[model samples]
Target chain A: MKNNVKKLSDYIDRLNWEKAPGAAECGELENLYAAVRRVKSLKPPVMPGADFPDKVVQSLARGIKRAKSRKRLLKSAAAAAAVLAVALLVYFAALKDTNIVSAMERAYGRVSAYHGTLEVVFTSGAGERQVQSVLDVWADKQGRYAIGVLEGAYQGLMTVSDGEKVWQSPPGEGALMPVFSETHEFIFELGGEIEALKAAQSARVAGEETVAGRPAYVLEVTPQGGLPYKLWVDKETKIPLQKEGAMHNAIQYTTRYIEITFAESIPDELIQVEGKNFREADIGEEESPAPAGESPDEAFEPQVRVEVDMQAEQAQQIAADSGSSPWRLDPVFTAQVFVSLQISPEGITGEYPVDYEDFTIARTDGRRMKVQVSSDKTEIKAVYLERLVRQDETGIWTVVGYDISR
Target chain B: MNEEGLKFAAEVCRQTWEPLYRYVYHKVQNREEAEDITQETYIRSLAYPKFREIGRAEYLAFFKAVAANLVKDRWRRNKKRGIQVGFDAAANLAFTEDPAEAVGERMLVEQALKTLSAEQRKVVELRIIRGYSVSETARMMGLKAGHVRVLQYRALKNLAVILSKEETSHEE
Candidate 1:
């Protein structure tokens, strides 16, 4: 009998499930094999409940909220000390490059909009690859801006900001994605901010050069803890004609702005999508149970509760656990870390910081939290967790609610 | 987590939840407990700061490890409950009573199958469930025939231990 059991186990191990015992087979061993076969035939049941996905998503939203509040507390505590140190450095450095900095500032200040061509070159295993894209940008003094990507793999991708609401058209997605206001502040507004100039490590007039047949003054500006890049300010109009720099210290890629322009009154249609066919999706929040004494529609808007303070250590732990950098959540936009394009001198090129900042809570209702992140100087991304009602089948007019989920 | 990270995590959950829940349910033997353990696995995974950094295969492995530990913890907690019925008695009762009871007994065996590693599970699923031959299973899983045999041996050995526990509890 023992030998029969051994023989049955060995035969099963050899993938001979269908092989029967000999004419003198032991009944006990045969019963065990039949039991095993019967068990193997039973299928596993599906997840026992419906709320499981919702429960998991809700837990995630809570986790994100806890992480964000903690990060905010840490940032506030550290901001003052860091600001003092940065202020002192800026004050000392400001004296040396006042003239050149002012000239570049004035040049960028007057531009309401610009049309230009961006040509990037980089080295790859096969050698060099050159990518050329048309750059169109519209900026207003009130901090509203729109950028259109007219060529490359990201040719149709567009980002627009109306100061309060930021919208993005991700490549291949015909709908517009509404994101947090801060996302625009981080990504779309270029180096025109005076604070950015004040933050520069050094600024100097490199020399005069002609860019695209226009004579220009090349002002080299190096931000603190950032790469040094040159701006060719047009000699006649004081507008920047070209910009050149290596995007990263680790990767040897040079990016150059080959052409540029400044325009008055950029048409509103270019920045804002006008249609009814788009579908809007919210990425971060999950549907939560409605509060007492409220209609379902009213309860859909989450109420804000008490904020949880987070320390740097907690943020670090979360970041470490999430396999992400803590600096991604920091509001301070450091130039070297945030620059958008990398082009090799050999013309092989790619976009830098391919995604937005690490996940951060843009807003939270008592029930759901919205996760949104701003790109350094190119894109704004939001993870849509909820589906919004839309009018058309082609899914053309997706309107993201900019209102903070209370 | 970032959008990409969240997207990746959502994909992982969508793909692995069933297998993970099945693995947990077999060891724990309660639907609610299995679901709780599965949820805990995901919640615990949130701490793995580089969730997006790892590949799908590595993430699934990590998830299984977490589930297995939870199951072990559950077993340790329930150890003092003592066996309710002898293995032979339960088998006899299952056969004589409602056929539904036999189905329940089969479920216990199915649960035991969940204890196998992903590789072993693949071997069982291919060779046993799909009725593939040894060489065929090996080719499908990209493993050597000898390795497949070893996996099958270990898997069945583990299943035997689980089945034996039922008898041992009955003896107690």
Candidate 2:
């Protein structure tokens, strides 16, 4: 364990951005590379619960709260000045580089719906071999879309959003999994780049090219203090046809619409898996939430409630001679964690390791107390001890939560 | 910044919150930390000189860079993407909007995962993706802990080989 900590610290200190080295440069540290990559967001994406956004909002408020009141006072006083600043910004932004950008933005924005295939090709150093991935994409004005993997290891994987819900089917045979609204990550706001380009200090029409059988104008744009990128826009329609550039580290790739067709309307079937059954998202379904707020659909509250005997000794109040937790109330708890909270009626057995990051509460009967899991059981994430041992809320401690990260 | 500028900045932060949080979440692999970093990314970006003048792409790039810096800070964090374009190969792609790159990277990795053997793939999923302890993974896989370690090393080696062959990522 000490060596692991030392290894991690050494690995971290070795990561020098001044050198801007890739994980490939970790040398013989393959284990570190793999671990680092996983931590870099490669986990199978989980759908966030319904109240996830609200939780983030609360967190965000907390994060920026220090300066908020001060800013609020100044902002209220500068309201008129801000209006002029916005107008001047608009005027200057409009004047700097208007035609191709504004035109291309208009072109991409005007269409209500379209079908297109994007193929991104990567070339090796020797240029002897090339690998390509193709996506079959369909989207409508109503924000419904379907993305099918046409070529790649995940060739059959499909993600569809039917305006109301997002469903994803893994690479092989499996039922579709619902992506809860809170955790649904991607919003393909098709032409969001155009707006991003509007702030670029430089955007110019460099030349012309033929893309997807249409003549197009190639525009070279450079954002402030940024590298330049080329975008091909159809001459007649102004829609973007291709984007080619080095994203970071100068690794190069070219993405183009190999096949595209404008349409008056896109059908709903194209945006939904009509016959497939979607597995229910487990969050807020049967799983116990944090003990206190205990909402059916939200992890919005930071603390859930747990009941302990207010009059009993602290150790005896938490468990019997061996020790355990309040999650003994549910059967699902057993499925997620190996430790069973119930052993006879004494509460938790010799197995439940409880040192307590959350300690006993000093609050009077019926008030919220702080409760949490010890490090030994980080895997059992969301278990609220339903209605505690003695009901009526007396001696109930709120689950303040823990890192739960191993 | 002026009140209207602050409002506009808030809107930009709001519009890109999902992708921003997702990006940070991937880096830290912890929900609370990701939330803090995501909000910090926006706050830091909003603090940039003349926040009103930057475009959404630039704004996104700035926030992603801040996110990257925050991750590195946890690992080591300052420095925005476009602001400090290194002369090295990695520096060239820093300003391209990051969420697209992120999505593309995920697709590439997922594609590569399909190439590994089932056992190797499962090892990677449980040990790495799921962050299960070695004992837990062994228990779930019905293998001894020693064997689970071997499987993990082999699976990573296989992934490195596959990813290198079809590499398009430009890391910074």
Candidate 3:
């Protein structure tokens, strides 16, 4: 046992000789220790629920039998399969760089790269004007858009855009990601969400059509999964518009480019929207921000972005518990925000106004935001954009961007 | 394949398959693929003569090396076909209790994990999650114990730094 330990140590040392320099003794030491452990493990433990080794041995025996036969059979099939599969793979690989794909990708890129702010208005039955502010714009190559809506400005606040990933207001906002956007493109007011519509297990290019007074190609896209999307593309500009998806609960998007302009000298500032708070994006990392001055409603628009982390409250709580502010959550916005709070850290110390969600909450250290019952409901709805208000330390108040449906 | 080589491969499957399965389960988060790779590791070990000379620790080290290679290869092949590879949808649904909190932690861990190199990530996962000792880890990963310690330090430092930066940005 002593000798084995020394050998294992030696083996371990040799592996790190570059860093440790000249550790021959260590390599042999590791080898000996490894040998001892291996031998010890060979004797199965007496404990209950220890069937792994036996099962492993049995499985291996079966695999050996199967592998031999598989090799023999595959040898014959591989020759034919390799020829066809390789040819197909290469052909598809080559097709990726074609004009058709480029046109489709360009359309998708147009939507994904769109950046600009627009206010969406939903006039309710009572002529009550509700305005929602949109931020950060980007679309996918498939013409799907992800947009971020200002949570405080909208009640039951959430952002919706078309893409594989759907973004919603972070938790504590009582907002769940709406499912309609997943099935329909029109629900979010996105135009031309799909670029290359695949049908019958292939990309389908439907004949020509006219869209918004522009000559366009109507492309039929049938996805193997999810609802199929129908796209209309501008023939001259190679731009697409009006992508409609879903058959059962069909959603249609009508896009009228009110105006189209391209600038070769694209300003970097146009793409950057300072102070926009982005939640965790549904898309993976390397998610592109929206392009400059483009409507957020364009299909494949980039998701709404916020400068502050959404989980600021949880992080604050952790810090409070740990007795140190190891983490801080601050709201980032280009514009100055004014807020009034109902709750405060020192227990109902009245209200004060501040700009941006993170800043407002940071002032109070995550105190609850509530609407006082004594307040007139109608007046509250009309004046205050949000329903609840909370204040942190430093006497800064934040509008609680949450839905108070009840 | 040599007789000893096949025996070593079989022994490797017997000793390391389950933990390996779990390790891969966390990375790709798929049971079917994890099982498939676990089986493949055994079959592959037979092709290398070094298998006969290695013990449990060395065998584990070899298997992990192969598993990492397979994962990259698998991802590339799937990507070529436009198939996105990552966590399975079913895995997300399985979390019913405190789903919000669980999801948050998972995202944080994933974001943190992404910062480490493949080798560093593997060492951290094995030593931290699998509870492998320095000695055992060195043997299984075929690294010197000192190298494992250095990798561990780098992994932890990277995670701490990344998390801290994110927190600072939030606070600001």
Candidate 4:
């Protein structure tokens, strides 16, 4: 009789799912629809080395120090590791048969936004690095609204999200450089929603586990999306403890929230800050200063800056060819100084038709200077020898080096 | 793996390896890159002495955070060089069979998910696909178990409504 009931329930479940258009499409459902897909091919566990003992001792020492210094008054003089150990021990000891999933949900429902300095260490394929941030995270009563200010290694970046829109300055301002999504919420929650990578295509749930001493459900979600992120959620607290993924543009990251505390007393000042334009500051830093008397009109108007560089070999070459020309000056005796003039934005301020081959100067808006030469390695090569000056985006003009063919 | 360490590693690996792979594959859209990152995640986890002490939630959270940062880094480098890597490599490994069907279905689901709130979508994913026990799903989402169940029910109903609308439109 009981088996029949279970069968009926299963049938209903299948029927309900089939009827729901809201269900993943037939094609989508098939991808994730594999029944009883066993998770095998386990990589033999690599044991923590003898170094574990020492590390554990050190961790204990650190924990004690932290407990002593903790201002919250909730933590005891116990080691942080010990605190975690004891919590897990107590949880297991009391409710040996308790349903972990239910306990977790009850605790998670109480979750609220936390604000504090969360020292985040980021490792990537390139190298292992740390990003220590004093982050201020706030969520509305509904837990949908959130905003944070992260101060890491490079610069301070703000993540303002109304449970929706998020924006930040480029990393030239010393923050995580933007990629894929232009916003923080989009990037952070890729595992949650953004399906461009086809998450459901290759996703599965692993068994139960514990995080931060709280029993947590393990969801092994692999998406057809190129990059996969592992999510470990506390079954008890329903908070995320560790997230491992690609790091540092190239390296992988093993990000863990070591000491997590939820405080109801997060002052408004903690989340609030002076709003300043940081992107502009960074752009200003990269830009060159504008030259004096270089008014916009002067920049637009035509002006001639003639550059003359003496080349003896070129003189000799010109002299060698002079015998074929009507001009009577001995090229060998005359200094073949390569003279080139740059035209301003207005138009050709000046032009010398004689000495140079195909020598021409043209001007265009934004780009004022142009050099033209017909042929002859000597003149063509000589024209490129002089250095050039350009005004950068910051309205500053600075000398730029040029490679001259010898 | 020490008894404790072994259990922790296995649990952590089981919980995360899939999502990490998916997360990396999606962002980098390359299998070898995703695999490399996934393997690297294990290596990094091995380095931490607290691996045994780590809670599953923290482990997964750390993994996602790391993967997200890596994706950003790769995205930046790729953008600077203006190179586009094909999604074939990652997609191939992700859907061992039926790539087209799998990808199409996932796209549809994700498209629909986007129309919902992030919280709602998360609830749906955890409840519907991963099949987390109600309490467990709530804990992972950091919401009350009741809230998780309530949200799951509502999200599912809404999704059903949406799917029905889509079907009707298609018929038209």
Candidate 5:
């Protein structure tokens, strides 16, 4: 029967040669099972010699060594070129115009306070949507600052710091969450964004252009692994009149800055969030409720539950015993782990020091554990280790998922 | 390269060289080219800065992906050069390289394989040629295990019919 043939075929394909029915038992399907086995056992015309593996290993070793030496040679050549360029710059200091990157850096450094309307247009599904927000930023040389978002989804978001603690109003919520100044200062300043632009792979002045009916210098910048952007700086004041760029490689979506202003000083009332209409909220104690019908005992077991502060060594030991990498214990290094887990870190080089409180370990049924690492504010980086069952031979626990922001 | 990197590269080469060489040899139908491509795959992988960072379990899959990309690039280059590249010609070339009886058997198998759909051929390649478990094949192909089993069963049944017809025609 057709059903018998299908069943016998499945059995043979499963490689249950013993359990698979014999020719007499399979009847008309006998040839099918034999054919399947023959197909499975068919070898390539040419088999690699026994020494192929060693040859491959030696070839790779040599290639890697050559690549390293070539990299060193290029580094030395680049250093020599840099010294010559510096000397040439000094000799032609009076004849040549100032570099656009330095000019832009100087212009932004002189700005103590600025306000602007940021208009961002991005594609969603079939159509486009625009988000317009009024941003007010104030900064001093001591790294003290305040930033206010007056429109868009982050209408109530306000952050103020007095060189110590940062009081931030949560987006869409009228509650002030205080965090360490060192942790949140970068979030409320434009200096960090400017510094990133200054470190772009290439920057050049693309002649003068008229922006908002005023003559401005058009500076084009291309960042590493990012799309290019153009900034129009006012010729008279050297302040940016407008900046625009495609968001990443999305040619259909664009982000632009409009209605910019530079101020001598911001109002004292605008720079402090203490008397603002916001209730204080402590985010450190907040935890999402566990899913219903899920028992903690069934999900995982706490290897070491410490309510008090513990040393880095204890955390490392807990990670090691749980079959997780000890590198997940350090907050700064854990960010790198997250990066490697999600994507390939081929040529990326930088330090990502996440401002966090501590880490907690919980052993799961599988050869993995749950790590709860909290940041300075409401954000908690919950890293869950996934025991790669198929790759258990390697004994590497991959980061299955993490909640870095939420 | 660091010691850990070298150890990892050696382990990967040990596990993957055979399957990778077979895959390339079948496509190119030339031993020398297949060996060159296999060696190049390892060299390119080791030269990558991220190769050492890749998890041990992922090394095989990464090597396969790299090998597949190299094969595709070679095919494109050959096409640009106006080379006569076809499955039948490659299969015939492989068959001619073997003994007389093996030539007949391999030609019959290659002919039967050509009868299957592209998706079915891929399943055969991953499950049979590569000797991957059903679940591993399913994961690689992004299909459910049940679906993969059904595909394999159908593909094998079709191969059986094709081979039977070839034998009958030969007898005639």
Candidate 6:
């Protein structure tokens, strides 16, 4: 009976209700036309609006905290191996009888927004290292995630992304570094577990087990190209809550969710690391009170003082060889005020004075700068660090970086 | 309610907010009304003398039952607002409003739905009424897509049989 319903469901899904179902279009089950029609007429789920979850919490005001601790709260108190014993209490509570194959699909499908603590134990690939984040990840639909390190060696680091850009706070520094190249290799494994099962030579339910206080189907499968895996899928929600992978006949790693909450449309603010205007940061430039009017442009522009007696020969020598060069440090304009500009023929006010980089040079260089800010490099290896500044959406100076002559 | 009881009630409110709102919204099919009913359900929970005594596990059921009764009251009011009865009057009912026959047909269908086993009923709700795709339903239930389809076919077939039986009984 269960399998019969499953097949009928698959057929209806394939139908997508594009046309009315009848004996002509659908055989044997033509009597339920009204039911199918009503389903088709029904509206899609209207996601709760205006920050629903946050508003509900705010509505509760003074009566949370201590009372909240009473309802299935996973005590995140155990140091290091806390989550080894973590129940993942209510996250996996809904799914009670799910198995391996269905669990993988559930985790892969239908999940657009989620927050969870992922405990990763390296069994072989790196030695014995266990990392369990008390507060781990909250990913929006865009896969822009905020990976938090709350109770580990990386106690205060947070990495957030806005699809096109990533923001990371250096451990203990609490400063937002604009972008970094961090591939969530573990997350790839989480989503990839499904594809692995699909590409597997054979997969079978090894047994039934309880993982994190939820009944789960234990699956043993060997993929076509990758490592063999043992997966625990929650019976109710079917979300793959825990994974144990093997290499060379030994357990290599296990990634388990200590707890998780799936919500409708996590706020954009979750992934926003604010006010990181890289151009405004004083790099190596020494900015002091301008002594006097040392420039011709000082009248219109605020008291321009060029106290820099930079080696002029070095700038000339650096620009000579690099054809249509983008990397130019006019010591005069940059020494006191390293203000970024669009540098057009009409030359915007606070630009690098004179033919710093002609359009031919600027265009060539601008494209490169645009690419770097968008690149996932953890650190920029540049003698001139001002290239890190990405312009605001409306600004003409969206890219401002150049490769040094060195 | 004492301070501790109020605190527990507040905690339950926080924990079950999303699911509670979804249930009300599903029943009312109106965002504004669902929100109002959801708020009202919580308000009643906080005000009820025995709210402090309700077990943590019973919070969801208690709230849902309250929402269900509220929905029934709403249906009664709409009936009072002149949903025309009798074949002659119902024949002329507007396209937007359900006719008297349609309401009877729905009641029959609802009775047929109740005859299904829990698993069968869930399949009908997720696949038929809720209109989740088989794949999506399969994912939610942690069942094979094939299994979901099979469940829906039997559930509907059973509904058709039960609905047919209801019609015969009404005629008799």
Query: What tens-digit string does per-residue lDDT give for candidate 5 at A1-406?
Result: 5575456434443432111122324434556555655565475446667887888888878877777776664678777688789989885683256665566678787987665444433332233343323344556645666665543333346666666655666554433222211223322234554675678788767889866334687878777644566766667666665555543212123333434555766667765666665433233432223347867443433332323223543444443333234222222233334543344334222322332224444333324446566645324456655334322212334454555563
Interface RMSD of each: 16.9, 10.7, 17.1, 19.1, 16.9, 13.8
Report lDDT (CA) for all predictions: 0.49, 0.51, 0.41, 0.39, 0.54, 0.49
Give RMSD (Å) of candidate 2 vs. truth.
24.5
The best candidate by DockQ is: 5
Model no. 6, DockQ:
0.09
Q: DockQ of candidates 1 onward, in order?
A: 0.05, 0.06, 0.06, 0.01, 0.16, 0.09
What's the lDDT for residue A331 in model 3?
A: 24
The best candidate in terms of TM-score: 2
Question: Taking candidate 6, what TM-score does its chain B reach relative to the real chain B?
Answer: 0.45
lDDT of 3 by residue, A250-330 (tens): 112222331232333324432233343334333223122223664323312212222333366444344322212211111
B64-127 per-residue lDDT for model 6 (tens digits): 7766666555545523443222222212222232368656765666777789999989987886
- Give lDDT: candidate 6, residue A162: 62
- The CAPRI classification for model 4 reads as incorrect
Residue A264 C-alpha lDDT in model 4? 62
Please give, for residues A152-264, the per-residue lDDT of candidate 6 as tens digits: 33334566666655545645343322221112222423455576677778888788997755568788876664546687877656777787755421224466765555777
Give the runs in model 6 whose Cα sits over 4 Å from its true position. A1-108, A124-135, A174-185, A188-190, A247-251, A276-406, B1-172
RMSD of each: 30.3, 24.5, 24.6, 28.9, 26.3, 25.3
Off by more than 4 A, model 2:
A1-31, A34-406, B1-9, B77-94, B97-118, B129-133, B161-172
The interface RMSD value for candidate 6 stands at: 13.8
Model 5: residues with Cα > 4 Å off, grouped in runs: A1-95, A123-129, A132-134, A170-190, A207-214, A224-227, A241-256, A277-406, B1-172
